[model samples]
Target: MTDEVAEDDYEEVVENVALCSECDDYMEHEILKERKVGTGRDLLLKCISCSAINNLQIREPKSISIPFILTDGPHSARVELAIDEDEVFNIGDVFEEDEMLWTINQILDKDKRKKKTILAIDASSISALRTDMVRVKITATRGEQSDSSSMLVEYGTKFTADTKIDYQGEVWRIRAIHTGAGRTLKGTVESQDIKRIYLHEPPNPEHFEPKTPRERRQAWKEGRLGYNPNPEIPKEITKKRVTPSNKRKKKRPRK
Candidate 1:
């Protein structure tokens, strides 16, 4: 009797939950009754949400079984998924379905089997520079042979005047720093000599220009281009046949 009670205490039904066909959510069910017909047992359950009745059959004792009460002890626990970077998993993507489901299950298990609907998800990465470390936004302008470009740079509090740093595959040294509004500092940087700087760093090349129209057409005909969708118009034209029209009977002028 003691062994039977211990077995009952640890008895858990790990059944694959079925979602509602109407609402597409897990249904809360309670076993209405069970009847033994011949050698098989039939269990009837009614969903609390939709009030829909579902019948389950039990042929073998160990095949599959669901508990009368779907949830165990308490279902109040909440689960949270915090991402420290950009979105790594998309829910609707087929390739990431397994990974997303695995991550969700891990969170649910850790939070005492909480429902997945209440799970909180955060996708933004934590900022490295805090409110105190932020110095000021400075306008950074770089001059090229033909044109000049400018961008707003965020200078941290740790950086000072005459400090060297790398930006956009080029070496730039800070020229000057001035006190700005609200405990901030504005800085300027200038380009240095084009010496052999970085190890294994490839040189930046000019923007690519597409070939001429005649060259592109030749490349397309030789199949050097990417995927081309051809409906095989020539083959289809051979299969098409013009149907003969029936001639109408001409009535006589006297009639």
Candidate 2:
């Protein structure tokens, strides 16, 4: 009797690395979250050293596995790797001897496997609702107006009009929210600002220009404006007409 080995006996491992700005060294980064965006995977990695945030994109590879059968070899066996009617195989991807080492080299239908755009929503909204700070996957997009932003969350996300969230290093208060019957919900937030700069008209540089002699003197004294005491004219290059290439050419056909 001979012993047999199965394909499920081995484990696969993948390593992800990132650089820490504070530590200035490459460190093993822990993946906080992964979102499918287009044809790649958007990964949020946290530096193990200083806990800094880093973004990484991982694209799909061309390798695809298909089944193959060993017929001419010493052992004629029936396996799942045998070519099926719907499967497509590439050259150099199949081996007659070892089934475990066979590597797929061709790409299948890439468009079908592609995912839609995924937005990284601010996780601080959960904390602002007075809930425990835990990792949550939410889909969101940018707001239409400046100084204000909106986010899309899954249905049943606990929040109210008074909810506060930290987005892009700034704290904002939720102003309005619209919940849908579907699994998605939209929410808007505005900056918690006390005052805003309102202008009647855009300031013109020429209008603010110091036209009067006293204004110009005051400007000079205050170091608000200055001009070059001595300016140097740039030297221009004069192009010289040279003869065309003297290389011989093939004879033209007679008209």
Candidate 3:
């Protein structure tokens, strides 16, 4: 008899031959190109098992350049103050444009009397509950009357409220101060704007009683309580009169 090889044995040999490489594994590769400086260069390589182009290289790029400046300290000051024992004010509170300008002027005026100068500062609008902080932009003036020389004021520590401010005879609580963004000061209010304030009395306690569904349905069916108007009824009832008929001449006898 002639020697015979099994199909399974031939299949295994073919599979092993398909992966003939240094790694002895199948894989796919793609080639990437990069131009070299001062020369026309081409780099090429083949994947071992899959025979694919594996000429790609991953290289790190150069670092980016950034500008640096030396400064003595930060450019702003900030503070946080409590309002009416509730709410806190940070940065970025919207206030009336006029009110904000007025507050800034007040700060500058106070600083001026003390021989201190604040170039330009911005204040946020008052909060609804009269609570928020303020940011102040501070700069020193050049000459005795010149507003040229200035420097940013750094917040040494948080300044609490010494006393509340009365705006137009209305008391407002000061929350905090923020001098970070140029010169901005913020203050929180304990009360809302006078015009916007609304007063409402407590609801009557008698309206709080709960009614059962059955009781409500009975009231509706009896017509005692309804949204629509009740139909009108006559005050007095009228009696009706009836008359008997007498039309009988002769009646035939029935068998």
| Best-matching candidate per TM-score | 2
How close is every model to the real structure, measured as TM-score?
0.16, 0.19, 0.17
Off by over 4 Å in 2: 1-24, 30-33, 38-40, 64-94, 97-255
- lDDT of candidate model 3 versus the reference: 0.31
RMSD of 1: 30.2
Superposed by TM-score, candidate 3 places the C-alpha of residue 120 at a distance from the truth, in angstroms, of: 34
- After aligning candidate 3 to the native by TM-score, how far in Å is the CA of 118 from where it should be? 37
* Evaluation by lDDT, superior candidate among 2 and 3: 2
Model 2 worst lDDT window (10 residues): 122-131
Model 3 clash tally, residue pairs: 36
lDDT of 1 at 120: 25
Please rank every candidate by TM-score, starting with the best: 2, 3, 1
TM-score of 3: 0.17
**Candidate 3 displacement at residue 214 in angstroms:** 68
RMSD after CA superposition, every candidate: 30.2, 33.8, 27.1
Candidate number with the higher lDDT (1 or 2): 2
Better of 2 and 3 by TM-score: 2
Can you write out model 2's per-residue Cα lDDT over 178-246, one digit (the tens) per residue? Answer: 333222123432221111211112234698889999888766655556764443232331123444478
Per-residue lDDT over 118-156 for candidate 3, one digit per residue giving the tens place of the 0 to 100 score: 222221222221123222222222224322222222223
